[model samples]
Target: MLVRPSLTPQGAALALAQWWELAGLEIPDLSKVRGGNPETGLTASTIVQSQEPNLTPARLVQGSHHPQVALVQAHRLAAACTSMDALYKALDAFEGCRLKANARTTVFADGRQGASIMVIGDVPGREDDEAGKPFLGPAGGLLDKMLGSIGLYRATNCYMTNLVPWRPPGDRSPTAEEIALCRPFVVRHIELAAPKAILMVGGLTGQTLLNSTDGIMKLRSQTLDYRLGLDAQGASTYAQCVFAPTYLLNRPIEKAAAWQDLKRFAQKISAMGIAI
Candidate 1:
């Protein structure tokens, strides 16, 4: 067995020289550590070395550095956005979020932007990806009926979007890193839309935006206060988190229970004087 030693620069040089000698090739000068200059044969150590350090190795290996710049750039872009139009435009221009690179187009939002009820889903699905809209898949079909049961519809009564604007590769649940990267855009969406009530769809969307670890079962069928806006802007606004349609779909037997919850939600909105 060829035992290896802990190699320092000097030891590495020695190893190289020994290997070259064994190979019967002219041993290169180790004093000049750098390779020959591009213009001249005279060699010297290089000032610039390797490529930039990959903070995210998975993204780097995938041949994209988009996700790396997402968090900071998203925050800056969202902060500069004062309206939904501006926010959408900024999101379109954002090259970060690896999902965006793989996705066919930007699935920003769908339905009525000014609607009092805002529905937020986990992320875009395959159908949504094809249409460049959030929801509209099998889950979306169920969502439409769910809303219709309470006399709400996307075309006229409600607005819809996702926790993420881009669909995850292979429709997988988004990673913590991916969610963190897209958070700023979600926050901005809420601020600009200013919906009277927010319906967070599924476990991931509910947990991430609400900053809770509680499962959907524990969190569902109850009204929870969600704080919006930054501390710098006087104070944060409050909204409600409702059960997602996906949860209802998973537990088909619980549709009746969801209906009851929806009724209560509708009543609350009615009390606020917003027509369903």
Candidate 2:
């Protein structure tokens, strides 16, 4: 058998250097990102989120109520859309939310349409943005495992999306104002999908959807109703908040509580007569 030739040491080194250059792979740009330490080896090193204030290209028109006005417009835009694809286009066309300007791409839903459960998370991370799908990378892997523990998979019973369809600069938690600005699209998404259940993956999801400023612990293990209209008799959806998978990755001990929450969530699905 003929042996495959490999590059020489010098040749390999030069090739790798050229490859990196072509890929533009360099130390993360600190100016447009925040909150990670490169010295610690990337865990320590996360790709700089693209929306860091005053770092990335300028976005966000600064006015006290301009954001609110923009959100109202977003709601109008969302309301006008009659389908998921339409809504996505509307969101893509939306110019108000500052996060959209710097984010790599819109990280939208991935999974079955009209699935029994819709899982919502905070903003997309670097991986999710790159893939243009929500729930990817380490946090996504953990989410897949957690869902499996309860006999669920995104491709099967669950649908995934984010509170903010874009990533915040520097992998930082999204500001409250940003969540509010992006809220309407998700509201429209839930309305169109009309899933029987929802899982809010972090405190941001909990706080924004529940309209409470409390932390996740204060909201965890609780089942709440999502208001679909002004009247109490209007269409509603059931939702629960759990510890975020990303957070759980950092603190593995939290897995037990998250597991308990999922089991209970499964029970709710069963109670609703939907087979898991």
On lDDT, the candidate that comes out on top is 2
Candidate 2: which pairs clash?
Answer: 34-170, 42-45, 49-170, 51-169
Judged by whole-model lDDT over C-alpha atoms, candidate 1 comes out at: 0.66
What digit string (tens of lDDT, one per residue) describes model 1 on residues 1-276? 111112222233344445545768664453433343566543221211112143222222333233322343456567678888878888777665777777887788988979878888888888999998987877889888878888888999789888888888898888765776677788779878887677777778777777677887766645665555654333332244556666667778878877776777777777778776
Q: How far is candidate 2 from the true structure (C-alpha RMSD, Å)?
A: 18.4
Cα lDDT tens digits, model 2, 7-46, are 2222322333344456666623332122234465421112
Which TM-score value belongs to model 1? 0.71
Range of the 10 consecutive residues with the lowest summed lDDT in candidate 2: 43-52
Instruction: Please tell me which predicted candidate would have the highest TM-score against the true structure.
Output: 2
TM-score quality measure for candidate 2: 0.75
Backbone clash pairs for candidate 1 read: none
CA lDDT of each prediction against the hidden true structure: 0.66, 0.70
Instruction: Give the total clashing residue pairs for model 1.
Output: 0
